[model samples]
Each structure stands twice: as C-alpha cells, then as structure tokens.
Target: MKKEYKIGLSIIGLLLLVFTFTDMNISNAVYNPESKFGLIFEAIGEFPSAIIATFCTVSLMLTREKDKSIKYNLGTVGYIVLLIFFSLMASMIPVKYLHGPKALIPILMAIYITVSYVIAKKCATTHKEELRRAAIVGILTFIFVIIAFNSIKFLWGRERYRHMIEVGSFAGHSMWFIPQGFASGNEFMSFPSGHSANAAIMAWITLIPTFVTSLKDKKSWFIRFAILWTLLVPVSRIVVGAHFASDVTMGVTITLVIFTLLKNKYINNLEEKDAIHMFI
Candidate 1:
C-alpha cells in the first residue's frame, strides 16, 4: 500500500507539471459550453457523489458490535436499516418541498443525528461505542474531505474551464503555472475541481470501514461502486464549464493520496488498538 501510494503521488505530480505547462492548449480542445454531450454529463455526474455519501453514512451507522451476541446485533442492525430506509425515502422527496436542495442538508443532519442517537439509545443500548464510532467515521470522512479540498483550493489558485480566453473570459488561459497573485483572481483559482475532490473523498470514505472487516463480498461491491463514482464525478466536472480535464484528474488524484494517507495513519491505528483490546 505504501509503495502504491508513493507511485500514485509521483504520477499525479508529473501530470500536474505537464498540465501546468500546457493548460491553455489542452483546455481549448474541449471548452465548449454549448455542447450537448458536455451538458448531459454535467447534469448526471453529481448523482454518483450523492450516492457514495449515502452509502458511507449507512455503512457507518450499521457497524458490527464486537461484544454483542449475533442475534441481538442482527436485531439492532435491522432497526438501523429501517432508519436508513426512511431517511433515504425522505431524501427522495422533492428538494423544493424541503425548501431547497441546500435546505435538505440540515434536514439530513438532523435525521442522521436523531436516528443515530435513537439507535444508540434504544436498539443497541449496550453497544454505544460501536454506534459512536460509526457516526464519527461518517462525519469525519465528510469533514476531512471538505477541509482537504478547500485547503488546497485556497492555496493553489487555477482558473476554471469557462474562465479561459476561448470561453470569452478576458483572463487568458494561463496554465496551472500562474499562482493567484501572479494572474487575475478569476484565472488563478482552478487547478483542482472541488467537486471532483469531494467525490473522490466520499468514495474512499465508503471503503475505509471495509479495511478491517471480513465482509469481502460487501467490500468488493463497494470497491466497484467507488471506482465507477470516482470516474464519473471527474468526467461531469470537466464536461461542464466548471473544470478542465486535467483539473478534475489532478483533483481526484491528489484527494485519493490524502485520503489514503489519513486513513492508514489514523483509521488503521484505531483498528489496531481495538484489535489489541480484543486479544487482551
């Protein structure tokens, strides 16, 4: 895993260098905002990320309790599943009915907390630790991904696809070579697509819990789903006027590196400590 991480980081760094040198020429080929293909891909791309987030949340809420009897644990899991089912059903209601898509966030948060608390309070009353860890993992996955993406965006400024000369923006398509202060503010803030990075992070989050679990079949399915989602999210951002192809690619690549490192260092450490306690 470490070797793979090193190799992946190296390849992404090389791509960053190459793209920085040829940003304008590369972006010019596919910067058309009016293309039907681009519009269609952009429209559907966001759905995968949402799906991944839901999967992560559900996985976190349904964690297995090490000390509980199988029969009792199964009952608790069934209850959690019902909670998730209702939450998902609520999500399907029209966003406007919830006030707006953005408004649904707080609603979902309330639902997650309420459901998690109820599950811990009643269903798995004796296994609160497991429930708390699950919630922590899900919430931490989201928080970490957002923090990582925004941190880089604030520091590394690159222009968006539509901000190029070809797209009618006065800001010349300065490649990734230009930092924020060196170029127009609009042109210098687009190196990595925040959307693409977020998607990658969510995909990884779905996989983190699987690392120490014996659920091979479930893990395989999630891996396939994450791979498909990771690919789609980047394509969607690029097809739209939001990000250049390289910008999306690099965003996912860098995010994967960050996610992997953090998971190994922190998540794996916790798992190891838990394993030791089990033996002791």
Candidate 2:
C-alpha cells in the first residue's frame, strides 16, 4: 500500500472512532433539513458515481474490439449490464428528488454521460493498457462499495434523524453499532450513508496519474479534491438530518478501503515495464 493511502486510512479510522461516540450529538447540533447548502447537496451528492460508472462503461466498451471470442463477448454483456444498473442507481435519487422540471434530469444525465464518454475514449485511446486496467479496478471498487454499504444499510435498519423528527418520537432511534435488521423502507436505511459512500468513490480520480502521465505531478491535487468532496458531502448529509456522523464516516471508510485494496492489487503491483507510471 502507498504511504499516502495508509495515512488516509488512518485518518478515516480515527474519525470513525471519534464519530462512534459523538454521532448523535453532532447530528443534533447540525440537523437542519431546510439549510440551502444541505438541500443542494442532497440533490447532487451522489453525482460522483455517475461519472465513475460512465468512464468505466466507456473503457470497457472500447475493449470490445480487442477480441471477438465468446468469453470476451460474454464479458461485454456483463459490462453493459453493470453500466446500465449503476447508471440508473446513481441518477435515480437526483432525478426523482430534484425540485425543477423533471425533463431536465434526463437531459442533464445525457450531457454528463456524453461528455464522460468522450473524455474516457480519448484517455483510453492514448493509454490503452493503463486505462483499461484502471477501469477494471474502478468497476470492481464501485461494485463492492455499493453492495457492501447498501447491504449494511438494509441490515442495520437504523432510522434517520429526520425520520425520527417526523415521527415525533426518539423510540426508533438506534446507535450506528446496533443492527435492527430488515429496514422496511428508505427511512430505515440510515446506519451508513449511501451518499457518503458514493462521494468517497470520487477518490478514483487520484488513479488518473497512473494513466495520464502529463498529470502525474498533479496527483496530490486530485487526492485533495477527492478527500474534500468525500468529506463535504457527508457534512451535507449530517446538516440535513439525513445521517449521523458515524453513518457517514462508516460509509466513506467502506469505499476508501475497497478502492485502496483493489487499486493496490491491480495497479500498484504491476510490473515496472508494464506502464510508464506507478500509482503511488
């Protein structure tokens, strides 16, 4: 593992530890469902997943030309399925919850996906092998992070602060460590914030340095941006009473761990001659 990733994980661990104790208190102080900043982020906080899914879809699509064998064809089908599933999952919340004309949601999604495809195609064309490898790591990270966090959310079945407020009862409130199991609806999937997990997946941008040699020097900037986005989105979730601090912390931790492990195994451990840059 890279020293930086180790440091990053350490910091996340410390935050999770602290939040475990202060989660409810922090949420109590910051809970403001009507805050303009919180509302704006509520609609857009999951946008990173759309960008990640689009790039992965583009990269995998470009790979279809390398072989026409049955195995490759099957893989192509799987890739397309994943792309559609993930894209829809990423866009559903924002589109459904947006306060404006519903028609604009599809238009904005089309534009973003189109732009992502173009950029991903250009990058993959220039650095074919590197980008393809990055795409695999990214796709695996996204899949695992989404599945793991959502599964935990369902199994934990903790109610959101906002939901508790609406019910006018703290009876349903549970700590992050408690698992009520089988949440009946969206209101109960609150132990781990899916928004925060999706936000943390933006960390995939940091891996661009491994493929885009020209931007290798700017890797730290990308990492900083990813970290900032990950933290900010969770803060928004907390401000809006959608999640406690522990929920967001655990959500971010899950993504960072999965991404770090996959990246280390697939990208960092590559033979020196296989690429021009190593993802440190």
- TM-scores vs. true structure, each candidate: 0.63, 0.88
What is the total number of backbone clashes in candidate 1?
Answer: 4
Off by over 4 Å in 1: 35-134, 154-157, 165-171, 182-188, 208-215, 274-280
Per-residue lDDT of candidate 2, residues 109-199 (tens digit) = 6666677678777887788778888888888888898889989988889999899889999899776787998999999999799999988
Error of 1 at 4 (Å): 1.6
Residue-pair clashes, model 2 = 0
- Which model scores highest in lDDT? 2
Clashing pairs in 2: none
Candidate 1 Cα lDDT to native? 0.59
Relative to the true structure, how large is the alpha-carbon lDDT of every model?
0.59, 0.82
